[model samples]
Target: MSSSMSVNPLWLFKVFPFLRWWPMVNGTATRADLLAGLTGAIIVLPQGVAFATIAGLPPEYGLYTAMVPAIIAALFGSSWHLVSGPTTAISIVVFGALSPFAEPGSAHYITLALTLTLLTGLFQFTMGIARLGTVVNFISHTVVIGFTAGAAILIASSQIKNFFGLSLPRGATFAQTMWAFFQQFDHINLHVMSVGLVTLLTGILVKRYTPRIPYMIAAMLVGSIYALILNQSLGDAVTGIRLLGALPSHLPPLSLPELDPHALSQIAPSALAVAMLGLTEAVSIARAVAVRAEQRIDGNQEFVGQGLSNMVGSFFSAYASSGSFNRSGLNYEAGARTPLAAVFASLFLGIILLLVAPLAAYLPIASMAAILFLVAYGLIDFHHIFAIIKASKRETAVLLVTFFSTLLVELEFAIYLGVLLSLIFYLMRTSRPNVISVVPDPRASHRPLVHAPDLPYCPQVQMLRIDGSLFFGAVNHVEQRLLELEQEHPQQKIIIINGRSINFLDIAGGEALVQEAKRRRRQGGDLYLYGIKPAVMEILQRGGFLEEIGPDHVFETRDEVIRHVFSVLDRDICMGCQQRIFHECKALPSPGGKPS
Candidate 1:
């Protein structure tokens, strides 16, 4: 083979990720993908329009978003089943961020949205290149559950005016919306409410009974048909039922976001919020589906894929997009074999758009609101929410704080707050490592160290096992505990630390240990360590802490520790003590030069 062929393919895979799965695209796989793509295309028709309504964008923009972004993400991302497009969380966030700056659905609003999408893409791409994918892990799963549930309520509340046919102000707060809703209770349009109720009920029944059918599409069709009947009987003038005018039946046209300094600066903050949320949604959905598809997901690759999709999508008049859990789940269940399924779905969506765009003229705003209500309801993960509440008070607090913050504060700020609280909680736990007193289990064959408070301890020596990293944050707590132990039992001057569980030891920890060793030596006893990991040993050695603590004091085995300490222990105390916790007591001699 040539030297060129002998070269590693890893670099090539980084540049062109689809190459990894291209060889698997056989006739069988293509056929499966085609079917899955068709199913996904059909499903996104109603969802694209509904999600667009939620985002305060023109309905066709939603369909356009699904096309270009989906194709780009599928080609570059590592997951075989993940389908990227507009999602509820991203949509609602876009609306929340931009609505204050410009009127929703206006030319100015669209321009701002495009700029936001471009900025978000840049953030994601930069993070991916910098290999900051692990940063998302800091945003706890509890935070997501809370944020999602809160966003769901926002979605439902946003549609109250349309759902009930009341004239509520745009950008109303949840409380204001509800208050206005009840105030205008007498003026509710019966015809619009009837259409929304019909759609909602139809969706509920169809989803419950007919699992195979796309319930949104079914509900949309039923709702549209029912609205037509009502309008014909009562006439449009009397019914007050509004229709979404016909959409343009064409491809996503070339467009440019305003790149002025003012526009960029204005949108930067919201763009970051969108970028983080989008990446979280995409990477999470990718990993979730990858588990079922038995594929390994590269989170950085996913970030890069999502970044490129939005960056390119911005030029094609597409709004910000991310991984759609519903569409991705459906794609996997429909037997999608490769990323080609997602590519096909996007292509089919474009084709489907050309055919169905004009049909949207008949789509009632009330019915769209009803569809969004269902979308909102679906976003709440009741199982995880209940589990978090039942399992842990700490997690429950995080969840509730995030959930309430999402409603009361700026949507993006809520995410930041949740992440901050999660980090604080994590730091609180790690900063206080478990400094447990342990004894050798007599019943176990290997006599492993166990935390048995009932076991009698030696008076001359104390043994402690630290169960967490000894970093800067935790060194103080560990040092304080050691100081307390010395104060409580001054006679037990010699100390042994089981360092096996200490995965990390920083400069501060090493310095603390050196001080501890010096203090112990002044009291006529020395600090010793056993089961110290090689990495930790290297740190201690590099810092000259091992010299201060005495190189001979560190042992590798429990037996070695016992024998060395027994030889140096106060044999006079052992002569009278009844507690012979260690088996070494059986053979060792007392201070009088006789076996006790």
Candidate 2:
């Protein structure tokens, strides 16, 4: 790391982007980073093995992911405290994507997993180079909530057989899994169920009451102790408990993915899903950590860093990797002063694995299942789920659709479906930009504007405000609404638009405004605008729309426009009005054109 940092700043920034934090490193920062790194290493030990199980990879591969990718992402990525590695979400996604292509845990499966990693890295790097980090924005928060909830169910279901010692078929659908559990209830293995129950109960208690201790480690310890006692009392043959076995102790070895055309074609769709999901997870974690660290993250740079990490990681036996939310948050809370903390964590993890590999032989499979159940449960954001359900009907629809699709459809496509539905709803809302009718607050001292549906408006003019952007996609809606306004009240030729809320305008919107002005002029009246933002004004001026609408027709405030427009209405018509809504109308003669 020091050797790499000794180069030119510009060159280092290009090659090792995290070197920017190099200058800030000193005795104090190094001590802090080492402490944070040690804390992270301790937390990831059990999590790595669990995540690898989720991905159907060898347990050691999870550690490899934590090591190589963590180091590379820290050195080349944007965020100071974001720790990249194997995550539950990414692991499950990898499993769901590639399980159809090859047998999970087989040599062929490992090869295909490497290939997918390479492709995902390539796609991510290209997107970064293209500066397309904003693509994640289209995937709404509701989509994430729905997909996670769905995935949580999938995770829990996948572990049910292991947790309960049931003989369910592998890779069964959610319904089949549940059905199998119920059918096998009478044949349940009490020993296995007891171990899982103890593990789950221990994890829940430790997490709730003593969060400082790594819950996975604490739970695994208790479950392993219980299993040892059971095995001692009743022989292993009678207990029928299984172990994770000793994990690989050596460093990650060199490997190559099968690059044949058939392999690429087989994995293409899955690779795309992995790439997009990895990016979304990584970027979201980075941004979330950045807020607490009071730092900024470069999404494109983070993309490139994650890409390079996975691309490089594939050759070193690491599967797809992304930012780990738990580890990153722990890094921040553990006093990480720089990205070096993540680097130190990778180094410490490698060292710890060498010492801890043999101890895994005593770890029971039921314990792992129990830990996963907890992880899956944690993924479901119940607070946000209830909030969405209570606050918005449309968002709730997105959440339900995404949640169900995740359970019913392919995991990858479920994400896409949620995003598609979200976009559809968004377009539907934006295309029909809210055209609100506003009136002066008669009860207010300064005549502020408010939406009062029952208020009596002047018969000759209508006051309206568009509360969204007027781009090509929305022009037709705005135009149609304006047309409807004219049709509804033919005598109200003047339309005063309160443009304060309109932040965007395109050529189509400009043309629509010009057409409205022209239509009003044809009827011996004209359109008036008030409180136009500078950006909208620029669009109007640049498109030669201000001339069409006439500069005198625009006003800086609603009150100014209303005052001037009141003077222009036919005096004879005003004389006959029974309801005098505006203060200007009070000065008019009673039932005649003469002044009062």
- Using lDDT as the measure, the top candidate is 1
- Can you list the residue pairs that collide in candidate 1? none
- Cα deviation at 264, candidate 1, in Å, is 1.2
Q: Can you give the TM-score per candidate against the true fold?
A: 0.97, 0.90
List clashing residue pairs in candidate 2.
none
Q: In candidate 2, what are the lDDT values of residues 508-559, reduced to their tens digit?
A: 9999999888978888988899999999999999899999888999999877
RMSD of 1: 1.7
- List the global CA lDDT of all models: 0.91, 0.88
lDDT of 1 by residue, 157-230 (tens): 99988988889989987788888888999999888999999999999999999988889999989999999998
- Whose TM-score is greatest here? 1
Candidate 2 similarity to native, TM-score? 0.90
